[model samples]
Target: MEKNSQAVFPNHQHSRGKAWRWTLWSVLLAAAVLIGVLQILVARAGPILKGRVVETLKTRFDSKVELDRLQVSILQGLNVTGGGLRIYPPDDVMAAGAKAPLISVDAFEFHAGLLGLVFKPMHVGAVHVRGLAIHIPPRKMRQQGAAKPRHLGKVKIEVDEIVCDDSQLVIGTDKPDKDPKLFELKHIVLRDVGPNAPWPYDAVLTNAVPKGDIHAAGSFGPWNTESPGDSSVMGDYRFDHADLNTIKGIGGILHSTGHFEGQLDRIAVQGTADVPDFSLDTANHPMYLKTEFSAVVDGTSGDTYLQPVQARLGESDFTCSGAVVNVKGKGHIIDLDVDVPAARIQDFLQLSVKTEPAVMSGVITTKTKLHIRPGPESVTQKLSLKGGFVLKRIHFTNPEVEDKVDMLSLRAEGNPKDAKPGAPDVHSLMTGQFEMSGGKLNFSNLNYTLPGASVALAGVYSLDGQQFEFTGKVRTQAKLSQMVASKWKSLLLKPVDPFFHKDGAGAVIPVKISGTKSAPKFGLNLGGKKPDQASR
Candidate 1:
């Protein structure tokens, strides 16, 4: 065949090769045109796509989180966020449907859209954030229950980077009882976290740092019914300067740090604080408690309210463990088991001694429970503790002592007055039995003021809270002595040894107070046939 004819017909292999080349060129040209169209379409559709996505997210999330600027790239399949975004993981992941609350980030850039980019994929860029606010829910917000059900889903908003200056943190959520007049935080600089990146934290809230009215930090996460103990968060908190209005009964320069972790509502903790100077001041300021201390508590789901607690006071170095329980709607118990090698009753008797003294300290080893029943009537008003204490030394200062023999071991009890079966019903509860034993009581050396100072030999004595009922004394034969003042000497009917004799100067001879617990009576026996005694 001629060249021209063969070319037209594509002779054999030449024809096959020519057809293959034409097919390849057509495919290339079509791909190039399609890509060009796709690029233009993406540019044109970006704004609309962004608006639709924004509306969709906004409608789904409600006002829990507000996303600032949103943009979408269809061609590259990418999205970005320029504002607030928060993520609240679901509480019960097992449940077919569960919801969590999310906080909004101030502003941030996000890269996420190539999830389906298989063969030739893409990389989403990083995000940015500014001015973030985090919240810790209390008893209030939990009860809200989505405020009439606008939608359903966990609170989740993803972001990239964050930058903050003056931010606030809410300790607990709002309650109908009115936000605690005391819990508020202002001016805080928090840390930053990420997904594929290490939790880079340069932030530090040390002593007196991150100054705010209140400070709270701990390992926090939403609840997981399947695994309650799977969380591994550490607690760390520092509240620099904050108002103490919420603790209506107490106030101060709140300096505290502690270990914390666990779910939001119920948390576990171990921490300490140094209240340099604190108070409950109205016009000026009324001081409440001042000391250094540490504490720990265990919490769980449902019954996880911080009930039983343990605390250690540094100044007195006393350790106390107890549970704060509300009983039968009338009594509030601060039930405790106390062990104070050196128990100083400063905070316990705040009103009695505005300024405390170191000598007022004592070593107290006892198992005591304090129950407080408050009532509008006298019958219901009582503070009771029934237990035994072995006192090392409890001082009621005697100025006459040039030697400062200011130590005495006293086993004393303060039982409530009496309770009547048919008596008018009141919120008051009786103070149970109080007792102290096995202690050395060294009163002031009385040598200078009168004669030789008197000191009681080691002994155990039991008194009826306010008076002496039946005196139980333990002693070695060592004689006890006392000094007599000239004025008081005239009052003694006879001169005798005060420690052993019933008729000696300054001798408080053993007397019995008796009667029904309801109406106690008192009696005295001084070498007499009978002495009238009844319950007081």
Candidate 2:
């Protein structure tokens, strides 16, 4: 009986151990299945999740927002594509028709750490924005009475890298009469843009202003989201070999290379500009220029000012300051101070007129304070130049005058360099001093002397119409009177020589030259002398 009982106990114990093993295997399999099912469900719900994200953005943002597609993944953060999102201004702003929301994009990517996103300070690995466009509206002064107390909002944005490709910016003016400007940027990349970064953010972008690549590095801080106008910004930007043809009003400048380092928010700035090859096409000739300039610009008002502008052109140096003021809509006032210590008339004429090299010769010095106000139809018609010009050792070459005067021959006869001490030489030069204002040149003293004749004149010349009217007398030395040909002596001097002799030396003749610069008529005043008496 004992042997039979022990055998049954062994069998029963073995059976119970087998059942427990089966139960443990079943539980493990069920848990594995549950996890797989949950993962499948999450994957299937991606579209629903994308919709929820769009709704959340619309609810949070004040402006209109839409997204075409949002792809979520456990391994990858978010891949947003297809759809240009536009944010329209508020109803009231739209009504004013001055503000517009103009941002569009082609693709974007966002990456964030899971634990960092929910726990402490959020840390984003990277964010890339591609094919973006931002439109800027023109500046307009806000109504003083309508200004409200501004409150700034805190900005909480961080990223390791932000990249933009194929972007554009449009800048418009508040005055609809003015033209808008456009800028195209390609391949913009930025790095380490976040709070408490180890170093300032570094950025690179292509600029359309001068059509060149731009590199920048700067520290950007605690940004005020609402009142960004008051935000402080500082940076250094460099642009190399930018074409100047894109700019207005100074399209003659071919190329420019420069750098700007300052606060962009203020009106005051300082920089250096170097124009390697600038060419200007004038009516008569073309001017080539190379300039090295430095200045402090203050643009607090509607117009800007460049004080103490220094430049070099050809063999001449210039130091001037200019201002544009009282700019309302289209026209403005131009005030300039020009001072040239010395310049060559030959050089000046080469740039201003089509003339022979030896036609005009002198060393000229000029000082002027000029104000040019726009006229009804012209910019310089109402110009006023208050200045003085000094010309030393002036000489004029006229083949016609040389033949009639024959100064060289007369000099040989009068000062036969054969043993004459301190003998006067043939005079072929003059000195002039004139006061210029209101397009009129008043020559208070105009004197020139030749070997046999001399002239002293006081007259006013009109620049607008190219008219010259003078009351002067020509004085001939005794030797010159003997050399004077019959035609001039009889036709001109014979009529007024006696009357003019009372006030001057030599055989003086009152002469007048009138008409256009191209065609001049010479006449004698005679001054009450009877025709028959003058003939004699």
Candidate 3:
């Protein structure tokens, strides 16, 4: 009986071991099946999620979408990778002649938790985009109608951050022939991206026109899907090392800081700019220039209207208002109304003239229209001015010129003996209407006044201070006979003094001024002869 019981126990143990093996096999089979199912789901998720991506972008942009490749992986959270994506503008916008896609990306990647993917609103930790390009349509092509309500449906997406290291933005104009404005972005970062919500952003970009680097940070969008150009934007920017030589006629190293707010199409900006070495190519003399300005800019067309600009050059102060407009084929045209209530003529001469120690000094007031046309010409050649100016307490720097003026005033006052030598400098007044072009100033109705004489003249003065030609009549209180120091000559000229006297003056004489500023010659105009010929 003992032997039989022992044998039964062994059989029972064997049966138990066999049962354990069978249970282990069943568990392994179930696990295999589950893994197969998961693999299949992951394989299919790529196409399904690809479709969702397309649908989301289409709804968000209100545009047609195209995608080249998509991949999905669930081993490490949920990873998605895509390439060759392009989003086109609305049909009507395309019909309006916009051929470029609204947005395009060469590659992109994002990651999310598997649980998050199944939730109502997907949460993505981060997204990285490469080779992105965004093109903004012209104002007329953008939808002017009321915006449509956004519906993200059951599956919405929220991203914590998005980064693009290389990107470009192009802004188009309504005119067919006009060139678009281009901005090259070196790096950009967007934070807390969600539907119909403003996204905070930081960016570094290069401006094409003035060729400068700009760093900006602010909030942009809550995007206007219907009219991207109408997207709201507010930011502060710092522009550095802007090379103004990109413009044909001017040269400067500019730095600016400003704040701007408004829709992309129309932005209001307040800023201050400093040019430590501002100069005209023709003059080649650098001057410190600074300005505080308020302006309105049309981003689409790159047109700016200056509400007002308060500027200082050296010690001189002025104000100007104008528009800088971009033409189709031609570059920008600058039209300004400039007013200088009080300025030093010496400051102007230092800026414009090549010679050191300006030829004259005085207080001047002027009102002028300044026009600059874009071309290959130098700034002096392209600049045109129409203005009127008044100069008070004028004093010539040259001793010879000052002495001559002093002598003339003494003689005119019938004090010829007082004009001997080393007399006190006399002040003068000058007023004129002037038009400047081709590096020359033409003066009309020019009036000059001193103690006892007044002269009216019309003439031209070259900018180089190389030539001066003037003809006019000088009226004085002294008789012509009294103008001579020689007693015999004075008596001989006394008989004909009545013939030279007129216009309520003791003597009226035709006078001419010619030669250079450094060596001006003053003479009597006996006939219509050249000033050189009339010089005594």
Candidate 4:
């Protein structure tokens, strides 16, 4: 009986051990089968996701899509890596001679967990893109069509974030000869990316023309597949340390802040720009310049039309409206209509002239057309102006010049006693039609008026205040004999007074002004010819 009990215990122990082994084998087999299924799913998902990506972009952009390589791995999670992806515009929408791809990417990578991948909208933690480039065609060249709505069928993609460290955006022009505008993006980040939804983005890019860094944050549209220029955009931007010297003719360190909204083709922008040391290269004299402007910008062609720009230079204020357009070979051409209600002439002279002190000081009003041609030439050489100006209470900065003018006024009034060395300063009025080119101002129908005399002149003056040539007729109210203090000299001049009298004036004399602003020469001109003509 004891032997039978021991054997039964051994048999029970063996049965328990067998049960444990069978359970272990079943668990191992289930795990192996699950791993095999996961492996198969990963393998199948690689091709399916690759095709989905291509199809999604093609349908979304209405363009041809290409993918060089796509790889999927599930080491810790489902990961995707793609290289050499490109999207080309559809034939119906592509511009005539346009061959560049609309978008291109060197490589991109993203990761998703297994549970995230099984969902209807796949949630990607982040997408890192390298060497992404976007090229937008000209507005005029793009054909109009209804955009096709985008759909992802059963599975959709949602990204938590997308980061691009280096990217580029090229905007093409309708004119074939013109160069395209380029923006180099240093960093870009888009959050909450989804289909047909506005994407919030923050970007830092370099402005090509001004050579500046721009930091912007905004929301951009899902997309405009039919006409990319019609894509809606709104943003706030800050441009810093923009070097205006890149334009060749001007120099300044500019800072600006602005807000913009509307479509890509036509954006409304309002901004203020400040340049603490703005200067023309010709003068090299810096001045503080500030402007508040409202403009419409054509993002496609890089053209800007100023509805109005209010500007302040030093203490003077002015308003202008114009267009800054991109020319074929000349780069940007700035054409503006400038109006100054009332400003100090010295402010203008100090900014444009090389002289340390302005040659004249007065209140000046002007209406002018200002045109600046882009070139390697200096600002003075490239600037052209057609205008009319009126000067009131004008006084020459030099006391000697003012004294000469006072003496002239005194002599013209037949007050010879007051024409001596200690005469008081006299203010004058000047009005003229002027044209400026090549750093020189030419005046026509120039009228200069004092208390007792008026002069009508035609002249040219160099901007450097180094050259002056003028011819005019001075009309005075007093007779020639009355201009002399001595009785004998008056008697001697009485015979010649009749010869000098003309045009209902007691005396009319042909006069000429020559030499520099510092030491002007005033003389009687019996022969009306320029100084160059006299030299010849």
Candidate 2: misplaced stretches above 4 Å? 1-98, 101-107, 110-122, 130-157, 165-188, 195-227, 230-277, 283-288, 294-302, 324-335, 356-358, 368-387, 395-496, 502-536
> Residue-wise lDDT of candidate 4 within 1-536, one digit each (tens)?
99999989999999999999999999999999999989888888888778777766765666688999999888878889998999987665564555788899999999988775566566787999999988887765566333555443443566789899789978787766567767798999988876588889999987876888899999987777767767788899999999998877679999999999998778899999999999985568899999999999877777889989999999999999999987777778899999999999988888887766788899999999999987878767888999999999898887788888888899889997789865987779999999999988888779999978999988888887777888889999898898888999999999999998998898999999998766778898898786567435
**How many clashing residue pairs, candidate 3?**
0
lDDT of 2 by residue, 123-159 (tens): 5566677777765433342111133343322333345
Residue 443 in candidate 4, Cα distance off native in Å: 1.1
User: Over the full model, what C-alpha lDDT does candidate 4 score relative to the true structure?
Assistant: 0.84
Backbone collision count in every prediction? 33, 0, 0, 0
Q: After superposition, how far is residue 251 of candidate 2 from its true place, in Å?
A: 7.4
Pairs that collide in candidate 2 are none
Better of 2 and 4 by lDDT: 4
Alpha-carbon deviation at 483 in model 2, angstroms: 6.6
By TM-score, is 1 or 4 better?
A: 4
* Local accuracy by lDDT, each model: 0.37, 0.51, 0.84, 0.84
Worst 10 residues of 2 by lDDT: 137-146
RMSD of each: 16.0, 9.4, 4.3, 3.3
Better of 3 and 4 by TM-score: 4
